[model samples]
Target: MNYFLMLSNSHADGVLSWYQTLRLEGRMCDVVLEAEGVKFPAHRTLLACSSDYFWSMFQDYTLESGAHTISLPALSSKGLEQILDFIYTSWIALSPSTLEVTLQAACYLQVTPAVDLCIEYISESIALDNCCFFANIAAHYGLSKAFTVSNSFIARSMCRILVAEQYKAELLELNLDSLQEVLAAEEMPGVKEMALLQLALDWLEYNPQSALQSNALLCRIRYSLVPPDELSRLSAIEPALCTPFIHSVVHKALNYHLQGPLQPLLQSVHTSLRTTNSKILLVGGGPEADRPQNQILAYEPRTRKFRPLSTTLPTKLQHQGVCVVGHFLFVLGGEVVKVDEESEKSAVMTVTDQVWRYDPRFDQWEEMEPLLQKRAQFTCCVVEGVIFAIGGRGQRGEPALSSVEKYTMNAGCWRSGVSLPHPVHGQACATEGTGIYISGGIYGNSPDSSKDVLFLHAFEGDAWQRRASMSIARFGHQMATVRGRIYAFLGMYEPFCDIEYYNPEQDLWTHLKPLLNDRFCYGLMATGGRRVLVFGGRKWQEGQEVCTTNVLEYDTEYDAWREVCKLPGPLCGTQCAIMTIQDPPET
Candidate 1:
């Protein structure tokens, strides 16, 4: 009896023929054998050989049953033959798509090569999808090119996707403008509400203007679509959503939509009086003074004009601490020197602890109670009518002091408060809430400086904590707060014109636009609203000293700096103070 066996076409026919001969020659064949055009001799002597062979046969049956035959890409006769050979002989070079299919098949069959090919092909085509899926995959694989491509597509399509997808937090990684656009374009009724609520809470946390703008846009859309009664109901559901957008909308609604003569515009005369107009207070030495007594020049906001404040001091002053409380300006300790008649250079002079108060109403100066400790290069901040003096140099600039004292206007006396943890001079101080943040200043003498930024909490009781450090290690830089961000500008370091902005919440520092000229010991004062006035500091050019009369105003809203007015006279380190004066009520 002749028998035949089915095996892969790549197997040698001679080898299988030898096996068949060996099985037939036995007294009883231990293998099942069949030949071409012949049936198996089952009745004569039938035997199952190896279990491995039986399992292999079973897998072939399973694959045939489960195989999904999809149309393959059209190929030449040779290519088709090669593909068939690969299936029958298990040897064929694969294309990208074919490799994906082979990989899927291999995974089903527990084949390693096929699985590897699939991963390779998917990696190469990472930029193929709309980026939502591929971006996630790229992030997993740590493929930078894939990430770049996917990020680009996700940013472009972010607006069109439903807000539900955005809530997944994966979309938060997108740029703020893209998120705003998506929130703005969403037209579904509840979508705007959800978007606004999420964005408003995010704004409260992140407080980016873009997020706030998104909240405003959603509020507008909600008002337009929902009825008045429904609007009230929705706000009741989410009170937080209403509060963030309300401040902006209330002002707009009151000015544009309300009727009747505007009720005489109850112009916040006192608040306005409390607000300072944008003006430059030029502080420097006047040419006529017997000594270099500190003097101030003022610039008008509306007319772009300059006026000299009638107030004058004893001599040319440097490193004075100035703070404004209501309409009264307090000028604290500063160093004064007299020019030597023989040498024509400034010589020994007195460093005074004299606290001088200047009233804008009288245009005069009055000597107040002297500070308990005479210090120069100190920083001052006014909170709740109490002036807090922090960090300065002691008499003769020998001992740097870390002492802090509070001057209460009610008692008309100076009292010791909490001292800073470390010594600092020429520090930038700004008040926020109940806390005062003091940033980058010089601690030790010349050639040895400190770049550390510290935050002192007097309300918390005598503890000074570290906050974010400035980008550049600098001293004699002017610090001011605008819209809740701390700005440090024009220090005496190598790059004298740089400006650094610190965000207290994020504990991060970002560089702002540089100054037009180098400035040292410059004056920086907030003008309320959106403007900050920066004035008089000494500038250097080719070993020659030029006292700067240049006045520059910074607009936070526009992110711009512009030259407002030039001082009439040379002013450097004059006792500089700023006060907001409201025009008197009309009769």
Candidate 2:
């Protein structure tokens, strides 16, 4: 049997303590390590056992193998002394002022314990004040953990660092790779992509030789988030951004802005927002009382909570056609209700041709070119980069208008398109692929709603082609395209909870699971894939029509409906859109 002997931890510590005492007393020293005129007398065996640098140097057939003294000109005296103390005592004192020099000496001497201690101290002590300095040293020494921590710190503080004058020098001092890493992060609050673009351009202007890295730096910008007008202006003046590579990137972004209805599906690195928190924006609407409100609420789906946005509509609008082109919200052709000052319950509804575009980037609204005709209760759908406003009521008590107007973004004008098969209002519109489909609505001079469906493919300057009609006629209903199929939900003039989907390929209509309760005039949108979310709407209860706050989700795959939650309050005639908003910084 082999005999094994091992000393206890306390006994082992005692031996190291004895060696340290001997070194401190300047007795039995075998080598003198000198740096910057400062000398440390230590045992060769102890240094060789503690550091790989000393171990390899003191080995046989080496330059310093038989030497009694070694000079290290690359290290500082104070840093060398601190490292030597840790090798024997197993403790090191580190401060922000001395951390750089100390870390350099430990890394140069291959003292792993001291290096690890210095990194740990840096990781815990990182702050906005010294983060850039720490990042520079960490990158030079190839310290991955330290580099990552310090780099992330700079990115998270970018909003403050960019605006504060004190950090201008530090920001300009960042290396190319470090600056790219900071700009690539999306966690910066209160900082927009346009500002980031300017920062990159400013850096390029300051460091003219860095033009070679212009493409790499510019690619970090989410150009889709920038306004098209501003992007066009910048491209004209900034020569560096006009390079072939950057030009192609910018072209892709400009095209993405015109996608409209298809923007959600065409998301890319350039188009995707820099925010992780996306909220559903519920635009202007009214209650069952027919009084439209101007409040806009942002609903967070993850938390199932609602918060009002700081920006609201310029004026109260109802039955408006809402659509998002790029990051802008367009509210067009709605009835502006003016409540009577004396008669609290009475109000006058005036049809307006005014068009308002809301830019979330600046939280400001601009009056765009108004519609060609004043209308309300119309349905708007974007196809092939054009917004088509379909049939609606022109004047207050007039018959439904069959005229259609097309708004081309590039032209900034609304032109007449082919008329509908017949004048209809309260129709639900949806875009399937590149085709625009309008479902059941009230026809001209007809007391009852019709189930007739109309289709216009590619907007070929042709008349509406009649498609398969729904099983039941729907008016004031909602229609959405999910998983490439058109789904029509229950609406007014129809008390049934029946839900159905239209198959264009088959030219057929099939009934799916019916809703638990009948709803109409509700805010409906396709979250993604085969799922659809429905917000507040008016429902019939106890022989009376009332507004409901119930929020329901429909899953086409399961053919089922369930109440997910409730809106902040009962809202009808509202428009809901999914938007990416920056999350508030953590306290």
Candidate 3:
């Protein structure tokens, strides 16, 4: 019986002849068997087989049955000859059109050497005209060298052909240097020079330092394209690049090109900003009031001011789980109280599990489902639109909770996550890029706080790791990141004048000037540009705690603090959220 199979041209690269001779001599009979009519079966035992037979057999096998089958496609005589040649000699050369199909077949057959040779040939043959399509395929298959070469070729050619006047700005999206090289090569006598200048100016506006080192190169090209007078006129372009150039003029800037650290604390803040920068809705209590009067305050960073936000809560609340996502602020469980008029009696306040959302657009609040477990003194942060409620002491005299629950913004549902490594209350939680940093809170049974900084990285991924400890212990302290540095503000502990800064990159902490007023549990918000605003918190004096309504602002640039605005009323346990907006002050 004779068996015939179709082969791809790519398999014609010369290993098949030896295998064919062995099969014909019946030396490989144990591994090579005859199937009915024009097809030979590979005896599952033969380690080596002709590429053509392998490709055909590969396409023919069904993984479902876990067995090999002889299946061949109908082919012209020429195609059949190529198949036989590859089966006998292990290699076949063919046209580009035929090569593409064979390449796919070779890959399917697990023929490594043949597939690689075809890819190399394609890469060498790629040109500007066919690069786009070829590059797409190369990128999809993770053929790095092929993709880069094809893209570079197209970019280089585009630069050479398109004149300054005819240059397509969309081409800038390709490769910057290649585009610049192309522009440099073209000789434009008229409006072409002006167009090139305009394109360069726009690029410099968006990214100044990107091409900083290449300024001399750009200047030389400019001199060639335009007269000195015209080049000088283009100097006053917006989004000035002159400053950066001057800053690096003295010395060549270090080209370390180092990537920023994947800090958990830093990632948390970035994640929050990307998810939403809507109106910050603050929830807290009024001074000395039972049935804490919950109020929402909104601040626009652009204007650098605050405005009261309207809410629809049936009663006031304080010490609530507050988190902002998109345009909505989710305010969870808090405490409130009732007063008796007939007997002038006061009672222990009642805790609530009510949840409310504040919409900035309408300045309105809507009621939502309450928490399954009521918590106060809890901290909440949003990660990937999911609000995580962490360690907060429950109702009065209730045990502190290590239970971590996550509220999904998309599903409008709450689910439990990996509990905290340690339960602590009055902790300051800050999110940087993708990680959450939970710093200094009351950890053990004792009220004595911890200086240990607990770092939870990629909290959504169930990975938690601790980092270096803080220089000082703090609870009810506020933490904010400005200029890539973390500032841990005043909080309760032995040191009454506690204020510290943490540098995650260095894994070191430095002490900053203490707050003008020593206080703990203040509403801290980073606002305007680089200002850290401290609202209200309790002040401890002579073993007594007093709530203060003073508002102080810390300038990160100057590393100094100055009192800004005072609260309308004395407040404690109030939420303060700040959002940045656009619009510069009138000069």
Candidate-wise lDDT, in order: 0.56, 0.84, 0.57
lDDT, candidate 3, equals 0.57
Ranking by TM-score: 2, 1, 3
Over 1-587, each residue of candidate 3 has an lDDT whose tens digit, in order, gives: 99998887755444455556765664544332222234443334232444544434434353512344433443333443444445455567765556555555554445555567656866778654455555555555555676666655554444342443333444443334433543444222112343555555565545555655446434423322233344445554433324465324211211111111111122222112111334434466556534356565655544446656444445667666666664355678767655665754674566677777654322446666567677777778877766777787877877777777877654566677768877788788777766677887887466788887866654545755777788888777778877677888877644557677777888888887766556766677776478887777777767877777777788887879887666766777677654422111112
lDDT of 1 by residue, 1-587 (tens): 99998778646555444444554454233222232222222111111121222234335455522322312232233333332333233354565435434433343334443344435545455432234554544455444555555555443343344334443354544444334443434222112233333543454345454544645434433232223344455556654445655645433433422221121122232112222353446555543322455556666667767666556664556666777665566778777666788976556666778887765433456778888888777888887667898888876647678889888765677888888877778777887767788876777565555567787665675678888788787766777888888887777744547787778889888887777667675557777678887766677778866667777888877778998877676666654555543222111
Overall local distance difference test of candidate 2: 0.84
- What TM-score do all the candidates reach, one by one? 0.50, 0.77, 0.49
Q: Which stretches of candidate 1 lie over 4 Å from their true place?
A: 1-280, 283-291, 314-316, 340-344, 580-587
* Candidate 2 lDDT over residue span 1-587, tens digit each: 99989768798678789889999899999899999998999999989988899999999989898888999999999999988888888989999888988898899889998999988998999876788888888888888898888878887777777777777567777777778888888677667788889888988988888989999999999898888888999999999889999999888888877764455456566765566776788888877657889988888777778888888898988888988766567889889988987886888888999998876655768888889999899999888668889999977779999999988876778899889978999989999877989988889989889889999875664878889999998888889888778899988847668989998899899999898787887898888667898989888889988988888889999998888888878898788877676654433
Backbone clash tally (model 3): 32
- Candidates 2 and 3 compared by lDDT, better number: 2
Judged by TM-score relative to the true structure, which candidate is superior, 1 or 3? 1
Error of 2 at 470 (Å): 2.9
**For every candidate structure, what is the RMSD over all alpha carbons to the true structure, in angstroms?**
21.1, 5.7, 24.9
**Clash count of each predicted structure:** 11, 0, 32
Q: Candidate 2's error at 534, in angstroms?
A: 2.3
Off by over 4 Å in 2: 1-52, 68-71, 77-95, 111-126, 144-149, 162-177, 180-187, 192-279, 286-288, 300-307, 493-496, 540-551, 560-569, 579-587
